[model samples]
Target: MDIRPLRCRDFRILMTSGVVTMFGSFITIVAVPYQIMRLTDSYLAVGAIGVVELVPMVLGGLWGGALADAMDRRRVIVLCEIGMAVLAAGLLVNALLPDPAFWPLYICAGGIAALDGLQRPSLNALIPRLMKRDEMAAANAIQGMRWQIGSIAGPALGGLLVTQVGIAAAYAVDLATFVVSFVLLAWLRPAPAPPGAERPSIKGIVVGVRYAFSRQELMGTYVVDIAAMFFAMPMALFPFVADDLRSPSSLGLFYAATSVGALAISLTSGWVRHVHRHGTAVLIAAGVWGAAVVGFGLASDVATALVFLVVAGAADMVSGLFRQTMWNQTIPDELRGRLAGIELLSFSIGPTLGQMRAGGMAAAIGLRGSIVSGGLLCVGACGALARVLPRFTAYDERTSPHGRAETTEPVQPADPGQL
Candidate 1:
């Protein structure tokens, strides 16, 4: 196969299961918001539900890393998948109730968030263990492709199912996909804990955090992502923006537009494998993302705004690919799970906080003002990070200490003519 990572037996199985689970997760992403809206008829209610899950998710992910380092990664993922499925079933039962209440959703959301926190690190850590180091860039690109497609199609499909078949049916679809993912998970052989790995404990978690903090280049990745998401994530303000654009019906389009751009970038990602300066690439892509978000805020028309959003998504995908490559190429297998936990925090918590920030900004100045100011701040923050962490900007995979050492060719008898 041209895709080198997929040639490995383990990565393929994990990718299949992960992709399926991703689609299922996206369905819930839509279903939860729609359910909240139906239950309370308030945007505040919809937003609050996300808040409920944020803390548990953050904690679960970090702690899960400790467990992953101490246990079999495959087992951790499978168990988390089971936990998530059970939680989804709970939501389904609640929806079926004659008088569906809002409270149970909070509990379910928290539970699922915790499971997600635990599962993601193990899965991410599994990729490097499953594939060759040099093949990591392509593998990351493929993962980006799957994620972009799932983000785009999942919400669109979820909206369709909820509107036509009802919320219960949507939940049923999510639950079914979980079963499929579980079966796929079962097909993979055990990915056991690394040799000399410490037992899961608070001290273990602390060590992971300290190691992550010790790496300046890695810190750059995490902090830059957080700044970009926190300042420029505009999802919370999309509905208001859509109304202003006089296309209230195009809310779904707004939500899916970024993924469209991301998908486009992913399909033609062969060039990334040849790039040696991964950290520089990450900084550049993150800059582009910030600029695009700024453009999105300033655009008056729906067409222009959608165009900006697409650019932002494409930029974000590029940034993500480089970051994942760095992680896969550099990290020791023993530290992989713990580091993945920190990575999860950057991507997940940033957006959660971003949504909250977007809401506040929208209320403070105006919808457009929020978008423009946030985007501008994102650009500034990223620029500052780049300046403050020059080490990351100068990091070239060709010279990176963390990169795998090159294998020397065995000497053979000189050509007869040369001899």
Candidate 2:
């Protein structure tokens, strides 16, 4: 719904590249899991993929953050995309073999995850540079819509391609998307290193971590996000959920349904500009996500379950918009990338652990019990986060010293209609 950011040439160009890459990423998302099921036919085996890549992802993110601060971010993004495309090609070649081995899939998956970890902080830190400071929240809302569109279309189409032509076709399409993205990226004007950036090193990463820790407001964003994701995410169990519904073909729908909810919310996100208390919005949205997941766990019908997933997805989009706005308006340019890297870890680690938790608990308590209990725990964790991290809850864009530091405009109360 927020369309102003597109007026900037650089933002539009950057978004064009993002749109293409996201489509490719979602294709890989479905292809990898579906391929594992075809090969070994075990939920635990599919879940183990996350575990294998966790360390690589953590390292890539931390190191990538430092690189973004100390080098040309545009170059880093292109290099990472090249790595991703090469890995996709690996998958394609293996799918062509007369007897494709399972291990190649693991290798490709792990490689791609690591590259993605390296790429995200650079991409995230680059966006604010492309647009005005006043447009931050709206820009994030628009970015969320781009991801939602890819999320909705990619899996549905990826599933069809995999089921019809084969995994080779899906991989081929994914590889092609990366090609278009690479070409687009090659033309972007460079975003050079910030002035006086320290060399990329573990010690540099530690300094970033320390800076993030000292600011309780920033920590609030990280803590609440980690808590919600670690406790409530059930995406790793979707195949089994589809199987329980006696509709294996609906597996892709299970993934896209959440996007449907998120897209609906993004279409009307202009109201977010009026919100002065971003931290409060984040917690409220996350609590809604927990509640919706609880509904999904209890759903007896496929339609009901999909609806609940949609609500959960909407809540997540809202939370992400506020969280990103918090980062852009408060953190100075020199520190943005390293902090974004920490932000990347907060988001990425929680989902990885959550998937592992979901898969293990599903094996023990049954899928429904695992999901329901996890949702309840997510709600409790968020409540605890709000109480303990008062700084996050009290973070108002209007008066906070941090928000005022880098803002182009002084915070002011606006008429509900004018913001």
Q: lDDT of each structure? A: 0.84, 0.85
> For residues 255-314, could you state the per-residue lDDT of candidate 2 as single tens digits?
888888888888999988889899999999899999999998898878888989989999
Weakest 10 consecutive residues of candidate 2 by summed lDDT? 410-419
Write model 1 residue lDDT over 289-403, tens digit each, in one string.
8788878888889999999999999999888989988887887778888889889878887898898899898889988888888888888887788789988888888788786
Question: What's the distance in Å from true for residue 292, model 2?
Answer: 1.0
**Backbone-clash count (model 2):** 0
Highest-scoring model, lDDT: 2
Provide the TM-score for each candidate, comma-separated. 0.93, 0.91
Question: Which stretches of candidate 1 lie above 4 Å from their native place?
Answer: 404-419
